[model samples]
Target: MPKQKGNLWTTMWISYLETCLNNYLYSGIWFQQFQKIIIPHSQSSLMTKRLVAYFLINKVLEETIRGDYCKNKNIQEQADPTLIPKTIITLNQVEASKFSYIVGWMLFKLIKRDYLMNSHPKFSVICILLRSLCTEKVEYDVLETKLQTTIIISRSEFVQFMYRLESLVIELFEKHNELGSNILRYVENSFLTNLHLNQTFIQILKSSNGENNSELENEDCKFIYERCVLIYMKSRQKTWRSVNNYIPKKGTASL
Candidate 1:
């Protein structure tokens, strides 16, 4: 049994080396000096299991954007703005969920750095990108906490963030009306499918001690809800027809 365990460890070591060689070979780096490590004792079961694990991790990476941003904690308050270029590329390659998280974290770091440096324009283009990345059903604890912190860093900074965010919403709506509608529909479907959105909203309202800002409640809220219900009806025609006829039109709520 001890010998068998040793062999397994040996295989793991060999696997890591192979992974490195695979990368180097593809890059054509150090090819001439590289000595090939032969798999003398092939262990199919072990290799297959590890391969499966790799695939799962890779899927998460692709779905979660390789976790590059979170993995590299070297991001400093005074880091180069040039990092945005790499971040953009990484975001484009990540899966939607992973990408959203990465964008959120990056925005948090930017806000933190900006606060430390006393920058007026903390809510820059990158900050806008962060909010845009937030899905209608976003639930990142880190993001929510940081968002509250950033907003409270100073009254003026909070106001600026809200103002900039409002501008961003308007700009996005104007720039991509059709696309925005579709995206909203998608978000609504997710809410309905999960059976948690309405409940969550209720909780939020309750937590506000019923003093929920009536100011933020506007025609847009009604429009958003109606749009979601309409989209829901379309997809669930047969299942929801009876209730669909009872749904209120735009600018009204039924509940």
Candidate 2:
């Protein structure tokens, strides 16, 4: 991507041509089979996954445009947008579900590689990415499979991640015009109450107050601690009271 193209990537971490999503053609699909007999299956390589995603998104876009055209069409008007009959692309429900999984795997690769944070992806892009990251909130989130590994963050790194998360929450709400439900569910169900992240915050604050880590004395860290306190109070949206000594100081919830 050129410097002039896509604001040279809003975040500037690392990027591929498609992150900006300008009509840049990354590749051309060359499958010999016609659309009627294709079976949608997951793929491991990013390139193949991109093609699967392209297929899925193209279906969605086609349906959406056709629907719009239909609603606006007159009773006697032609049904097709091009006024010529073409093979209609149809997908089974189970097959359609694989699309998100394919795209999500690629998005996770982007996040794990720090592709998104460094580049300023558009809000629509952010919206899609956020949906994939936040899991559905239940009374207790299901335990992960042993096959999936957990990420271990240092105290400083944890603080930075939380700060970035808070910044994103504000950005989506203020600039994007609406708060995302997935992020809201994450904050309410997982983030505010997570023992690991909250515990990390407590240590960072304690280290700052103890004057042992001068690097953690910045105002952003201070605000993150305070904001965590505030959000903790709002966690689970219950009528709650605070416990003074163990909260901001101990990294335990006051409510």
Candidate 3:
């Protein structure tokens, strides 16, 4: 079992290296590399499963951002400003929808297992890509679908995910206010429909009671707490609400 896991890890790392090369080379070598390194072990390991998702995401993003297909005048005019090289090609609505489904399915699998922590290198890469996707209006459906499908089976892991997500949301808002607002709206809508998620948020809020734990005192957690309050208000209006009580006072820390 250990040997199998070791081989899987090596294959995934090699695939990632090939992806980086493909991103620059774009010489059709990635397909050949994938066939040799990824296909044989594809059904045998967790790392391979994630590598498949990562490869798909990389392919989709590459095609959407720099593919020859996006060179048409009409599509060029609609390119997302936040993504680098504004002159590059952008995905159309249909492509955006397909991309979203792929990401949503990936997140569904990731969140269901505790194997990937928020600090995992590949997990962080996934988050960065998701954040970049948020820059494109056409990709909002994918973000929304991810939120709708995400399940919080573990409180700690869920809290970590929220911390990462809040940072992405704030960064998006800072870069493009309208896009940020739209993403938040989707989150609000998703939270409203997923009662269990709301309850989980409330539970986290309740657990933080006046403690000075290092995790809660971190800047990411502080900002996440603030955002949680805003989202909670939008989803449920109640005079008795006290989640805001957890928000650190002014001058408490620099966020």
Q: What is the lDDT of candidate 2?
A: 0.36
Off by over 4 Å in 3: 1-89, 118-255
Off by over 4 Å in 2: 1-183, 211-255
Poorest lDDT segment (10 consecutive residues) of candidate 2: 239-248
Backbone clash count, each prediction separately: 1, 6, 0
Q: By descending lDDT, how would the candidates be arranged?
A: 3, 2, 1
TM-scores, in order shown? 0.16, 0.19, 0.18
lDDT of 3 by residue, 177-238 (tens): 22321333333333334333444444454354333233333334333334443433332222
Ten-residue stretch with the least lDDT total in model 1: 82-91
lDDT of 2 by residue, 21-140 (tens): 324333333232322235445336656665765687667655864454343333213221121112223336784344233333333333343343336333233334333333322243
User: RMSD, each candidate, Å?
Assistant: 22.2, 23.9, 22.2
What lDDT does candidate 2 reach at residue 200?
Answer: 56
